[model samples]
Each structure stands twice: as C-alpha cells, then as structure tokens.
Target: MRPQLHLTAPQNWMNDPNGLIYYQGMYHIFYQHFPYTCEWGTMHWGHAVSRDLIHYEHLPIALYPSKYYDRNGCFSGSAIEYQGKMYLYYTAIRYAKENPEYIHVQYSDDDLIASQAVVISEDGYHFDNRDCKHLVVDVIKDQNLGDVRHTRDPKVWIGHDGYIYMVVGSKVSNGCGYDGEVLFYKSEDGVHFTYQNRFIDSSIGDMWECPDILTIDKQDYMIFSPENIDVAPRPNSNAVIMPVAFDEKTCSLTKLDTYMYLDYGLDFYAPQTFVDEYKNRVMFGWLRMRKPVEGENWCGMLTMPRVLTQKGGHIYQQVHPHIQKLFNQKTNTIDFDEPFLMRISMLENEDVFLGGLHLYIQDDCLWCNREAISIHEDKVCNLTHTPPLNQRYDLEIYYDGQVFEIFINDGYYVLSQIVYKIIKEQTKIKNIELYKLSKIQ
Candidate 1:
C-alpha cells in the first residue's frame, strides 16, 4: 500500500526530488518521474503543491524531454524566485555519439552523458521548453573542471551580494581513485554564469549527487548524497551534512567539522530544503532504493516534511508542526489495525532494551514476538542504538498503512520502510500515547 501522509506519484517510478520552493502562499515540489512505466526510463519533472506540508495536490508535469538540450531526460536541480518570477536550474541530459576523452580514461567507449540547462516560468505552474535557446550553461570543455560527462545536478541560489551562485556535481581523478567534486559558478544575472571555485574534493565519496546549501543562524551547511562509500548499518547512497564556513571575500567554503549522515536508514536520499512561508528551513527527501513490493503498481515516496534546527553544533530534525495538526484524537491503548501516531519514552532510571525483540516470517505468518517492536511483513528495518541507563529515550512513530516512519529522540536518528507482508496478529507497545490521524481530504 502507498503511504497516506507521504508524497508519491500516482503511478510509475519516481526518484530524486528537485526544485523545492515556496511562492504565492503555496509550497511547490518537483521530482524525477517516469510516467510511462513503473521502471526507470525517460525522466520528467513531476509537480505538486500544498498549502500545508501534510496534504498535497498533484499538478501537471512541469518539464519534459521536449528540447535537444534536455531530450535525454530532465534530471535533478533547484528553484528560485527572482523579481516575482520562478526560475528552475536543472540538469538537462543529452547523449552524444562519441564518448568524451575523460570518460575513456575510467570507463569504456559506451559511457557518455551531459547535462546543463535552465528554464523559466512567468507563473509557477507552467515552464517554457519550446526551444533550446533558453540554455544558460553549455558542456564544459575545460579538462581541469573534472569529467564533463559526469557533471549534473545544478543547485542555484542568490547570495547576499545579490549575485546568483550555482554548484554542480562532477568527478575528478586523483591518479589512484576518482573523487567527487562540486564546481561553483557565479552570475551577475540569474541566467549567465561564470566559473568560480570547486569544493569538497577527494575528501568524501567518489561521486556526489544532488548538492545543496542551507544557511541557519549565519552558519552554512552543505548537503549532498555521495556514491560508493561504505557506511555501515545504512545504505552506501546516503546523504551527508557538513558544517561549513563560507568566506564571502574569497567565495569559498571551509569545512568546520567532519560530515555525518543525514538519516541512518535504508530509504532516504537526495534531500532538498527551502525556506517556507513561516521562515523555517523545511526539508524533504526521496525515499529511494528500497525493496520493491510484491504486487504494488507504484514506487518511491517522499519523507515527511521536517523542520531543521541547529543546536550546540548539531543539526536536529523534527516533523513540521503542520503535520502534527492532523492528529485529531488521542488514546492510551494501541490500535494495531489503523493509521496512528505513537510516541514512546522510557521511564526515569530505566533502560529500554530492544535486543530481545524478534520479527520474522515463520509458517508464512507475520509475527512480532517482542512487546517493544512492531512488524508487518518482510520489512523489519530498525535503528540500532544503545539507551543510557538512567536517561530517557524518546521515539515518535507515524504509522500510515504499510509505511512506518520512526523518529528517535526527536530525529537524531530515523528509520523508515514500506512493509509488504501481511500482518497475522496484533501487536502492542507500552508507555506510548496513541493518536488516530484524520485522513486527508
């Protein structure tokens, strides 16, 4: 079953989220969608909007593979509002007959893909892609800028100096291994861009995708999803958050501390953030690379909108307050059959043990043998963390149909998955307040 509160395409495959913004009293989100089939194919920009982040209304496709600049696909990117108009900077893909020289060094003669383009809209709902003349950036011929074939995913924003800045993900070779790099560009006008600087070279993963920057309390934070990195207890394609200090004088970023995973789970990736109408940093992530359901026709879902805050040098995430307003009634007893909100906490001087819980398939029955754990079917994804002896551990769970989103200690850790197997018995949890969520109209 599809998620009730989360955003997903009505049909077909969806992947990385792109172009998140708020304009004209509505929150708009765009994503990589293949509408023709359930499998990954030609990508298009699937659009949606919501007054409140909890309930969404799907709109028409914003961008498609119509022009030569983006004939291959419309990949990931970001959006900005300029002079009451909406501008979308996206990775427009086009295949070439001959492979680039850089691709021949590391890959065979078969791998060659390039993307760089921008589209504008007078109204936020419609975009212009009739001609390829709207192209702002072209294929890079500079060898020092890294592999041009691998350069994509443009993230653009306006700096305090009123100059527009863009960051694009690319790959650079370091004699022994290929390292991920993000090339920077600056434009006096939002369309024409000039090369600035490159950052996060060879220190992170081999390839970075969907790069973004968020500023909170005058502190800069860089976010991106890296590939080919070994991250235990989580997927290798994980999003990372690094605290960075931006030097306006030099137009560069200095790493202030080490990077950490944004979510310690299997389903989160390609997260993007935007300032909402309430002036809060709201973030949404694509729930990708998960096990497919047996008979489901649709795939991919977005994580619940989370408000980000930095406290004591750590970034904290919590469910947006607009979502909490959907909880209409509260009760003390658990209802295992319906969609609900659950909050669990440990008592004083007590440790909540989770090791004894066992969820498995036996005799074709979906069984959850432990009181603290809940199970529906084959998906038994859970976060592994030790609780302090005398400290309290809080867990907030949103159960909507077969989807379960677990937020531990106010989102210091999060676990989410879609359970496909059927539930054979009832399960209960203690020290939890159960609230029945009113279904969205």
Candidate 2:
C-alpha cells in the first residue's frame, strides 16, 4: 500500500518511470529501481500496472543486466510501439571496463509483437527479455558530444514523419554532477541510431534528467526536472515546461517560449506525459526528489496523475477527478471570491502573516503592529490599511494546500510553497471566516 502523502515503491529506491504505455486495457509503468537498497545501486526496470492510476498492481522486475556491459544494471529509457511491436530503447547501466568511466546500452529480447494486433498484450500482461541485455543504442564518441558514459534517461517517440526519434539525458563536462543535455538522435529503423544534436543545455540550473516533449492544443511542450541543490520540500530549481517547434526535416528543437514549472509544490519532478486514447494529455512523475519517510521500508513517490490543459497558452495541471474515488478524504469549500477580515487578541502585541497564507492586499497597504508574533489566543487579520501610495502588490500566502494560497495582489503572486511537508491542514481563520470552508483539518 502507498504511504499517505509521500509516495513509496513496494520494494526499493525508484527514480523515474520508463516504458510507460497502455496495452490492451492496462497501463504499465517501469522505473529505475534498486530493489536491494534504500539508496542507489545496480539498476533494473521495475514493473507495475493499473486499470486506473490509483490502484497499481505490482509485477515481476521487467529487465535485468545479466550480461557484461549491462551486468551493472538497466538504467532508464522509454518504450514505444513501433511497426506493430513494443520496443523499449533504454540505457544500459554499466561503467567503463578499462577506466570505469563509460556507459553503454542493454537490450531485452521480449519485445512488443505486432502480429498479435495488440498494443502491448491483447491476450494479457506478459513480456520477456528476448534480447536479454543485448546492446541496442550504443554511445559512439563524436566531436560535439562528451563522455557518453554519463548518459541515461531515454525518451522515444514516433516523429510526425512516421520515423522514430529519441532524446537521451546525459551529463556534460563529463561526470560533473548537475550539468547535462537531452541529446537527440533518429533511426529510420528503430534499431540503428545516429546522434543528431543536443536539444537543451545542462546549465538550466538543475540536473538535466528525464526529458520529454509533448504537444497539446496546437502547442508543443518540453518537460524536464532540475536536479539542483535546493531539492525537496523546496524548489528543486523549477520543473520546466518549455515550448518547442520540432522541424521534422532538421530534427532540431526550436526553443519556443519561456520555461514554466508544472506545479508550485516541492515534491514533484522527473515527469513523463502521454495523450490517452480519449486524447486527454495526462501526466505522472516521480514525487519527492529525495528518500521516503522512514520505517515504511520504501523511498521516493509518484505524483497524483493529472490531465494537462492549456489556458491563455500556459499549461495548467489539475488532479484528475477520478482519483477522488481512491482517496478517502475530500476538500471542503472556501470562498476565494469574497473578502474576509479578522482581529485576534494581541497576546504578544505583534502580527505575522505567513507567505503560505494568501491574503489579498490589492492596491492597498497593510500595517501590522509587528512583522511576527507567537501567541495563540486572539488575533487580527484585518484588511483595513491601504498602501500610502495606493499601489497594490500580489497577496502574501504561506501555503500547504489545505491552507489558503492568500492571493497577494489580484493573484499576481501567492506566497505559497509545495516543497516541504506541513503536519496539519489549515482550519478556519481565527479572526476571520469568509465563504464556505469544507476542508478537514
């Protein structure tokens, strides 16, 4: 069972999910799993399936590195339906034999077969490593490219031209921790591939990992998570959703608009998305970049699945409505439209408003007796003072979902965060109560 709040795998440390596809009527998710430890170790593809995202059924480990190059592990990659078969193109988790600095590919003999006229397995969920760690995509050294030994995280797709293309994640400047690129390549036949170009730079402030490009509602999107220093319960740099226009002939990404984060939460990253049979652009990603809450015997988590929708060109992700069927709790209502003010007794003679609590001061100035206070009895959340200059800024909000995202000035900025975990859900305002509030505390 998944622990509440933080997501945990059934067995071990899981980084990112690969080979995600729906076959017959089931959804499959594979990830970089090290079953032996709570930490990083030899990589293997872990498997699970769900008719719905909420109820996941675990399966046997999908691919293992039983061969020489891949003996270390099967790192990360993607699964695609090609020529009527399901083919997984991923990185083989191996190090340099001579210098211990190189990386390679691992293959699986159990591929997607088209003759059956099924997506993955029309008969049922069954796959075998037929290739059995055979090298499929190799790291051939080229001038523009650096040490391929640091490459992994392969994303494959059928290009608009009906050919196959893959974008692999790699660390540049050699093995330097956080800098990498989503290296691009193409294959007339899904087997043989040649390097085309580096689509994105590694300097975008986060470890360049799990690069996926998606197009929804007549626009293109490039998805990636930053492995920056300030990870977890805080921004891990911001997960990027940049716009792109892929030139089918050139096979190069023309960077579109500015990059935006998928959510304001700290626990989300390494996301991969797909359009469902119904054409809804749904996405799921590894939740919480760090280890799990102790004693549960598992670490890492996956975010609640959400459908991607665009409004005024910005992609907005909302938790899928259906997940509520699995969830035991529900959010009550709060009036975001009406204004509410309060006055708590000044036990300490000073007032502190959290960036987490969103309070609109639209074009108005608020003066607190003090910037902070530490008493519980009585308080004041009055919206009385207007700015001397009559200028309004975004509302200041100290948020943890259940708490208000106090819209500062007209929703321009709500001082709220999703990176850290809060022990309690917010309750009724002591000094104020506006519209209906249904959320349980």
Each prediction's TM-score versus the true structure: 0.86, 0.68
Please write out the lDDT profile of model 2 over residues 258-337, one tens digit for every residue. 66556443335677886555667877776543444335466666655567777777676654555433333223333333
* Residues 1-441 of candidate 1: C-alpha lDDT, one tens digit per residue: 567788888888888888999988888989998887676766789999989887788999988877776776788899999888899888877666523543112243224566677888888987877843267678777756767677888989888888898988887778887898888888887889888888856778888888887898778999988886655533566788899987654568878998887765455789999899989998899876344466777778888898999887878888889887888788765554566788777444343322233333233222223323333333333443322312435667787655666676777656665555434343524566779877666
The candidate maximizing TM-score is 1
Q: Which pairs, if any, clash in model 1?
A: none
User: lDDT of all predictions, in order shown?
Assistant: 0.73, 0.53
Lowest summed-lDDT stretch of 10 residues in model 1?
102-111
List runs of model 1 lying over 4 Å from the truth. 97-110, 231-234, 289-292, 332-337, 346-391, 422-426, 439-441
lDDT of 1 at 143: 53
Q: Give the TM-score of candidate 1.
A: 0.86
